[model samples]
Target: MAATEQEESLDDLPPSAKLVFKVLEYNGPLTQKGIAEETMLSARTVRYALERLEGISLVTEDVYFADARQNLYQLTEPAEEFTASDGEEATCAD
Candidate 1:
């Protein structure tokens, strides 16, 4: 999709959700702990954002290879398309 269109799609997301998206984009797949650390969000906050993102079909989680206790998350195609937009540089809250 075009960048502008992508940005528009992201317009409904809350700031926390946007932050999770950016972290996933920059770091590739990440565990919950990694996301919390990278985004400087509390673990509970990250979980909440991930759940919200997943509800929108924007993010997905999978089992981590080395650690069964952890799940790695990454952006779905739609999310990548959204973040690629040019109207604004997406920012994640620290």
Candidate 2:
């Protein structure tokens, strides 16, 4: 899909998911606990947001080397460009 199309798709995501995405975009990769703390969102809410972001191919998850039990989440390459090229943070209207 084109960049514009993917961005449009992001617009359709829930506010929680959009907030999660913005957090990852600015903070770099983070584990679920980190995301929950940063966003002050419940663990279940963070997990749900991560799932939605993952489903849309905006976020990628990988093993967290520091803690084997946890996984790290970050923006996918294409998703990174969506923000980097624009030089602005995507707004999340909740």
Candidate 3:
């Protein structure tokens, strides 16, 4: 299906949060710093996005195995699940 940005499952989230979700969706788990670098968002914004996603159980937060001070972020399910749950369209790659 040809999906538009508005058709994404993260419609209820801010664009930055959706972007963070997409980043994790495609790149697997990454540290907050990695996410900030990847999305070009500020650290604070990334934190907010993670908090939002976690609140809905759409994302998971874990301590980085290699780093004691940083946290890793990743999606809880496949891209399709996010869309399917919201009755929207999956907008990310496998």
RMSD per candidate (Å) reads 9.8, 8.7, 8.7
Cα lDDT listed for each candidate? 0.83, 0.89, 0.84
Candidate 2 lDDT over residue span 1-94, tens digit each: 6675456567888899999999999999999999999999999999999998987788999999999999999998875534645677766456
Encode model 1's per-residue lDDT on 1-94: one tens digit a residue.
Answer: 5664455445587898899998898889999999999999988999998987887678888999989999989988755445647777666556
- Report the error of model 2 at residue 47, Å: 0.4
Runs in model 3 with CA error above 4 Å?
Answer: 1-9, 78-94
Global lDDT for candidate 1?
A: 0.83
* TM agreement with the true structure for every prediction: 0.71, 0.75, 0.71
In model 2, which regions exceed 4 Å deviation?
1-8, 79-94
Looking at model 2, report the run of 10 residues with the lowest lDDT sum: 78-87
What is candidate 3's TM-score against the reference? Answer: 0.71
Off by over 4 Å in 1: 1-9, 79-94
Position 87, candidate 1: lDDT:
75
